[model samples]
Target: MSHSMRPLLPNSPNPPRIETSSSSSSSSQHRTKRVATPAACEACRRRKSKCSAERPRCSVCVERQTPCEYTTLPTETHLRAQRRKLSNLEIRCQAYEDLFGILRSRSEEEIAQILQRLRTGEDAQTIVKTVQDGDLLLQLSLKPEFRFRYIFPYSGEMPRHLKDAQNPYIRSLLYEKTVTHLVQPPMYIETLKEISDESQKMYIAPYHTVELDDPRISSMIVSNWTTVSSDNPMLRMLLQIYFVFEFPFHPCFHKDFFLEDMFIGITRFCSPLLVNAVLATAWHGYTRMKNRAEYWQPHNLGYRFLAEALRLFELEQETPTITTVQAAAIINLVYNLNGIDELGWVYTHKSFGMAQKISLFTPNPEESTEWQMVAGVTAWCLFNWQALITFHTFQPPVINDPPSRPLPDVDEEPAYYGEILVKYPFGKEPVRIYNGSVFKAISQFRVILNDITKSFFNPSRTYSPISFEAAIEFRSKLRIWYEDLPQPLQARHIVLPCHLKIHIHYHIVLISLFEPHLHTDNAYNGVNPDMIVSQSRICFETLMRIYYLRHGFECLDTTLVQFLHLLGFSTLDEISVTENGSAANEAIRSTLMLCAKGLWEQGQNYYLSEAVFRMLRQSMSVEDVTILGDIVEVEDGDGPLNLMAQELRSRWPIGAFSKADDSKDRTLEHFIHWWQQYSEEKAQDISAMEQDGPVVPPRYPQRYGT
Candidate 1:
């Protein structure tokens, strides 16, 4: 037969083929037989016949009506693939087991409680504590994949500004050294037990008092009391303003109780010092609101009331109570309002001392009285005030350190003074009452402020440059604290005084964080010039915002003055680097001038403001003279111009003039003469420039440029 016509079959000594008897039977009976190898099938192997290795059943086994099975081991490649699949399954099983273990350890009740609190907007720290106590958090933390899942899940998407490593403030906070130092276990007061006795006595010393023998002082106090008791129109208005404006920012007393007491003729029961302090604070706020310059004089109504309050406080024979501490804090605030920072610091110190004496810092847990809550809030206020003073004056805080006692939880209490309706972007609604949460947040920020002061601004500490990492960590914490604030406290556009103050303080901390870089040419080594300029602009913008909000009224306090001083120095530095008459340079100059003019107007008792104003004026005069091409020579300080330059150089080391170019320096006297002669000419140019645009840079000779 031909190869094409032959039936296919396995090779064998004798191939079997069926013969057809009939056409139909032939088609069915004629079949091809397949061969099997030795390894193909058990049936074929046992029968000693060749079989095809097909799946399910080999051809030889099928034709014989027997089952087929392979008994060979798998190849190494196949085994490896199977082992990989099994390993993946084992890993998934282990993960599930870990999750189940965590769930098993946490009771349903505990998890339910945590979920309920989270739904109700409980503080993040409280919720974290709940989970941590249940040990579920611990398990999650132990695993690398789940470490940040619960605690800091949002860390992956931080704000762009925060993530920028080139940003000086952020850079400082990100420094590894800073993070390590900040996160270390706090150093406890090891000598607490040893010094407990002495500390108690020392704290109480501020409250020890002799009975008042001065009849005049007592009569003045009595008169002030009569005025408050009678509710004269002016006094009533002041009190209302205090409640509406000042009290929210500095809540020393419960508003409802104070108002109720006043209405019920309970003024007699209240301490005279406390009453006088309130009157003084109210009057101070009123005068500032009214922009009454005369009322800020030494013997004005505010000062008289403040003096009487101090006199009564000094004469009290009893131990200082919550009211007494409140009185001291109010009086301290009054001092700050009058731009007497030294006195403000003194009074704040006394208030903190009295607060410590009464154990306000370490309150009795058994007591849940309103007074206890007020005392706790007062302690935190004192801490905030102390931090501000420390930052501004570069002084160490007299309050020792942050208290270990937790802040009072008073959110459940009724809102003080009912709901204060405030007009906001979301329409008029009751402003959120400042409660324990606000107090606690501010207290926490104060602790950070204290650290910053010690690390960067403390005059007593040995000079230590703040690492970029430390600054960034602090800044990060501040930002997180702000971001995590309750909706009510996070209003930026509402213009609530208390809320504004919080915002201002936050920016103040930011300014302080960048202030070190401002003096990069002097102390801060290797800091970028761009960073200094940017930070200075931030400070100016923040100050300008405050100025616009208050419109220069009631904003001349120590903190404000210090802010302006820093702004002045920073502006001068900015001007020194930027080209004169350029838009950037002029904008900085305008801000400096505006700040100087404002400070000069309100800077009667404020020495710091006066100094800042003078510096700004000097800087402006130097810029003007330089623009007019009046270069002065200082060779051995022979001429009046040379003397003037030397004096200017001494006063302002970071002045507009380049130190390398000794001929650029000009003395105050020489500057004054030049200003007098150039005033009219400059006015016309400035006016024209204001109407048109920035003045063109004037061409100068090579010697003059030098």
Candidate 2:
């Protein structure tokens, strides 16, 4: 403060002077030292040289005349190191989740074994890695997809193993390949297997949009869940039934894209409306206890799903996607299956109108390169189904004609085969694949069908009535379509239900075209009545003969009901007008009762069946009912059918359907046996005839038009 001990003032002229003090220091130097006193500096550590622990610099650093730096990582380097540790922890957590999912579906014994392995000190990542890399699948996974859509139907690539074949027909043809799969491999419920119906019960709840892949999603979708939050067991079951049974025949949306999008939480090719609609359509899978009143009740699983779908439909009605159009159509199918025909037609109109609005009928060129190979498949499927329903109801089509979208090139990709449960002649519920190519075949055939529908049921049909000549042309077209079918879809090909359905659909159109003409024009126009009767009879008898193989007539195909209604009424009409209860009418009466029996069995599962059954009963007179009294069932709760069942139960003490008397020739059981025998004999006769003079598959139809 002072120089030479002079007086120091506040404003001294010569105040500057240096004074030495041991304590005075800059405040900055008080900070904790960067390098530890007990450790070598970074330079010494790097050189692997022994060093004195120093305050600022190590002796090794001093000797080298280099800056002595401490071991303090930079911000980025520190963050990187921390990130690696976090990543390792995250991986371990993921392994735990995967293991938990795997162990959940396993039996208690398996859980015990796995838990024991874990408890005995197996590391999670190690165990998870082993499980992932191995063939031991204890958890649900994507079923080993055959990607059958990629396998060409006409490929020269011989399947080294039948199991490896693209078509189920190839796998089913060999004697040694008669094995059947009862239930599909586990799908969905991947992380929620332990969740009870209560835990994951599907209901409209507070929704937050899931992270979606498609940016085109609307505000409504952005604010709402696309489907119910989690995959409940009911949802899982219905999904299985839908993809396996309904999708192939319909082929409304691309299955592969929907499935992938579904798992990834994306609403691109899938939506709440579409998922719920498909689930509602597949609600026919509720075959647990057939006599339960819940089959048609609002409390039923399907109805609940349908309600949610309709809610979403209302919300997104202003901002529709291709999925919305698909949803609306499938919802119509739900109504159709339930026999709500008017609603079905209304939705049919709605869905197709939506399709038109979205320009699906004439898709954008950019749309052709979108995710699904068949971008327009939904539009094609929608109107075609509407056409079929319209044809049956004798209602005008929803559209004057389906817009000319080229038929989907199904062979453009490997065919996707949905493993649906099918009943075979071999007495097994064999899992059959509804080949994507089969639907392609249907699309081709539908071109002619669409033409036929327009010819007969066009709104303007009164101006240009469905004349005999036009009918002949359409008839020729149908026959040609039948002959031109791919080898596996031919009339004689009994490989899949879809094959039979295609044949049935073809024959129904033929029956509609010819039956009215049968007694008049067909008889005089060289159209054989025998051929028409034989055609329908064989198809239907085969269905009845093999009913046990096809889930015992649990309304597997709702469209079948429409076809049955047509075939059934015409067949019953022949005997319904009969007055005499003589031996001449007995056989026909038995056959008619068998038809009623089919309806009666269906009634056990569907109110639509009960409704159709009532309509059929209404067509018969008291005398006709009396003539078929012992054998025929009239309708439920209408006294006759219940009484008959009661009477049989009282007298015969019947157990189950399979336990019913075979000797009682008038009983349904006896008819099933009789029909089976008749079908076998007919098949043998046809086979022998083919051997004597082979009836070659008809040539590709000359009338096919793009």
Please give, for residues 1-706, the per-residue lDDT of candidate 2 as tens digits: 8568767668878886564563335534665665433445677777888766554776777888878875533333334656767877865665675576556534587577777889989987676556543321221122222210111111212223222233233333221111232222242233223333321211100000001112222111111332432223223444655655567677678776776567666888877778778767766744443432233456565666778898989998788888888888888776655645445656777877777787787756565455334455676677668666555444456665665666544455443322233221111123334365576667666667667656654455542336556767787787777777766565434444566677667755665565544445345377674466456554544443232232233334555455555545555545544545754355444445555656655665545655555445545555545544554444333243322222211111111111112332222223223334544565677555568543322111111111
Q: Which candidate is the best by lDDT?
A: 2
lDDT of candidates 1 onward, in order: 0.48, 0.51
* Cand. 1 Cα-lDDT: 0.48
Runs in model 2 lying further than 4 Å from the true structure? 1-231, 289-296, 371-374, 415-434, 457-465, 521-551, 576-586, 618-706
Best by TM-score: 2
For residue 648, model 2's alpha carbon misses the true position, in angstroms, by 30
Cα deviation at 656, candidate 2, in Å, is 33
lDDT by residue (tens digit), candidate 1, 1-706: 6456667777888776655568657676656543323354567768888767666788887887887876542322334656767876864554343333333434587557655776897854444434433332221112222210111111212223233444333222112222222221222122222333331211111100101122222112122353323223234444544554555555665555444444544652256688788777666434322333233345466666777788888875257876687788788766655434445666676777787787877768786665554555566666776776655544555665776555534455544222332221112122343444555566777888877767753466643546655666677788888787655456332223354456556765665565454444433345453464455445335434333322232322334444455555555556667787776666655555544545554444333344334434445544543432322211211232222222221122222211223454332233434444544465567565477654332222112222
